[model samples]
Target: MKKDKPKYKLIIDAAVVVIAENGYHHAQVSKIAKQAGVADGTIYLYFKNKEDILISLFEEKMGQFVQKIRNKMSGTDDAVDQLKVLVESHFQMLADDHHLAIVTQLELRQSNKDIRMRINKVLKEYLVLIDDVLQRGVDSGSLSEDLDIRLARQMVFGTIDEVATSWVISDQKYSITELSPGVHRLLVKGLCK
Candidate 1:
């Protein structure tokens, strides 16, 4: 049976909040069902299990995130500008969705090793976008051709992840958007020729 798009979104949104509030081990289908305002059995109709819910939540949110950045980058021709937009968009998305930020940065990490591995797979799409920008910069002579794409991508992603996690731990007092320019500058300096 086909599910309504809004209903599916609501379920995912509710799951994020439930998971964020309760660690993964404590997050039960019943809790998510209550958060979504659906019966416990209704969750089963949509998801096979709690792990399924978590995986789907990551997939849905990350998919939309990647698509939004892809659309935004379509208007910019410069690789450097695209990289800036990608960094800004990523930080801004996490900042704008505090619930999602908690889920992604905190609760999601509480999952077992296996689940974390699957979540990493979903995150690769975003990392690939970063790599694409770096490759473009190298091709355009804006960045050093000798830069190792894999290591550069890791540094960029790892730095941003650390920054975001620190903000989340600190209660997010300052605006994450403010860090975008500095991050862009540092990345460009490290990678540019």
Candidate 2:
């Protein structure tokens, strides 16, 4: 698969920077290629167009995001601890990659319906992870037995999403990771029995 190639990763990473700096509409294939240190034609080998690159970039980054959270969650069986891990990992990864944070929180939001739909499809895997944690908490009776998994999952994701958007909008003036514990506690309180 093309994803297994080194240039695919380089192109993806470069697309993140290019898209972040230029905004998706203005980001040209040449710019992405230059950022990746490859010829513009090389980009065509891996992607159909700019939209494809944007989608692939998100797919690549979000894949890593889910894997990292899963790895962190492996150390704990407690639903609450797993939630904490998810929250912290979410904040920390974005905090560590400013370009990625910008692409995700800002540029990605400006995408068209088709792009948004594809992005949402990729997001389902992440939302499912949250559903798992909420289900576990409810099963253990730590969270409200009457809790609606779908609603809780939305609230959890929306809260984290809004907070990250605010940070990106403010030019990342504060430490997003520092807000994780507070965010975790607030969400947990609502779901807890």
Candidate 3:
């Protein structure tokens, strides 16, 4: 019900910028409200507290993240093409939204253990998408029949994730999306027959 309100989205988007700039520890609810152009008390109508806002923020953005990747993966025949699309799409999306990258790569990792666990829960959907691609390759005889999909999925996700973190750490000095082809090449070599 609350999500249907315009203020809900306003608060969520505001939280992204606030959390990215201030870090979760220092991002107060009042600041978020001010950024959203709402009363500080209005934030409570949409969220229980700052923690709720943070978790909801992750849930919302990560949900869109997965959906966008899934959309990009659609209508692609070859598993190899699909995999490439996945890498490029992931990089391009993050690169296009630097604030989101900061929120996802940096601030998201700073929460408590329990909160991190919840964040991982959202991340699992994305990992599963990778697994599906690897599984498709194996089934279609494009990838090795003996391929360990679980490990491959982990490696693929790990590579993309580490590269993104490194880019963020390096202040995006280089083109992250431009590295997609090379990253996909390396990943494909390991997956194919």
Candidate 4:
């Protein structure tokens, strides 16, 4: 598959920077190729068009994002600890990658309906991870037994998402990672009490 190639990753990384700097609509393939230090035609070999690049880039980044959270949470068995890990990891990832933060919190939202739909498809895996943590919490009685998994998942994800977006909008003037504890506490309280 094209994803296995080094160039595919190069293009994806390049696309992230390009899209973040220029916004999705203005991120031309030639610009991405130049950023990746590849010929313009080379991108075609890996993607159908600009839209394909956007979808694939999101898919790749989000996959890595979920994996990173999983790895970080692996040391803990407590659902509450796992939830904290997820919140901390989510904020830390955006804090670590400013470009990625901009793209995800801003440019990605600016995409058309079809692209947004595809991005949602990619997001399902991450949501399932959240659901798993919530399920574990209910099982362990750390969270409300009456907790609606679907609603709680949305709230947890939405809260984390809003905080990140606010950071991006403020030009990242403050430490988003430092706010992780507060965010975690808020979610835990909602889930537990």
Candidate 5:
């Protein structure tokens, strides 16, 4: 119910900027509230505490992110084209929002064990999405039938993830989206029969 409210989105969007700038540990609820133009106590009205906010933030953002990627790749029969769409969408999303890129690629890594675990839980859905794409390629013989789906998923996800992390670390010095075609070709070639 709260997720449907305008203020909920405002708070979530505000948390992205505050957390990216301050790091998760230093990103105070008051700071996020101020950024959202809401009272500090209002944060508690929606979230249990700072960790809850962080978890909710990732859940909300990544849920939307994965859904968008799926939507983009839908109706595409070619596995290679699906891979390209995934690569392009992933890079474009971060490139479109630097603050979100920082929050996802950098600050999210600083979370505690429980927080990190929850973050990983959200990430598993994405990993599974990648796996499904790989399975489709195998089923259609676009990729090697004997390909190890697990390792392929790791390679695809790891490559994209490393690229994003490097881009974030470099202060966005270069175009991350420009490398999508190359990344797509490299991964698809390795996966192809």
Candidate 6:
């Protein structure tokens, strides 16, 4: 029987949950297959190996994330607001999906160097979007021209990442969505003139 796109997406979703619940080392193909409701052999038909599934998952989900933010920010011309949307959208994406939060914030980091590199490749698109916003700010004289775009991008990413990781570690007790404005303010204050 031929599998459809939705079926593949379902498998990836199941894999994310399995990986999040069980660390990467402990999450076996068989376990993911069971969680995905497909036979172990069937998983092979869709993915070459476990690593492929992970890379594919990041690509698919992160692609959607970038697309959504791009769509939402279309009418907003202010670089600061663009930056705000970027940060908020990122946190909101993870917040909306607890399973994805666990997988992205915890389990995915447990992968080896190569897998991590691949994940970074998938994340570059988002980083580029941040960089574009910073560049626009500099161009408009809204942000300090002396600021290092690369380091600034890293700072934004690092801050949001640390915040999300903290939330995950704390069992998500606080409202991540509520923190967006403050985070955006701090970032803007530091980066702007």
For residues 1-193, write the lDDT of model 5, one tens digit per residue: 9999999999999999999899888999999999999999999889999899989999998999899989988879788898999999999999999999999998888878888999999999999989999999999999999999999999999999999999999999999999999999899889997
TM-scores for every predicted model: 0.95, 0.99, 0.96, 0.98, 0.98, 0.94
Error of 6 at 59 (Å): 1.0
**Cα deviation of 67 in candidate 5 (Å)?**
1.0
* Alpha carbon lDDT of each predicted model: 0.88, 0.95, 0.90, 0.95, 0.93, 0.89
Give model 5 RMSD, 1 decimal. 0.8
In candidate 6, what are the lDDT values of residues 72-178, reduced to their tens digit? Answer: 88878788989999889988998899888988999889889999999999999999988988899899888898989999999999999999999998988988988
- lDDT-better candidate, 1 vs 5: 5
RMSD of each: 1.4, 0.6, 1.1, 0.7, 0.8, 1.9
Global fold similarity of model 3 (TM-score): 0.96
Candidate 2 residue pairs in backbone clash: none
Off by over 4 Å in 3: none
TM-score of decoy 5: 0.98
Task: Give the better candidate number (3 or 4) by lDDT.
Answer: 4
Local accuracy of candidate 2 as per-residue lDDT tens digits, 1-193: 9999999999999999999888899999999999999999999999999999999999999998999899889998899999999999999999999999999999988999999999999999999999999999999988899999999999999999999999999999999999999999999999998
- Arrange candidates, best lDDT first: 4, 2, 5, 3, 6, 1
Off by over 4 Å in 6: 1-4
How far residue 106's Cα lies from its native spot in candidate 6, in Å, is 1.2
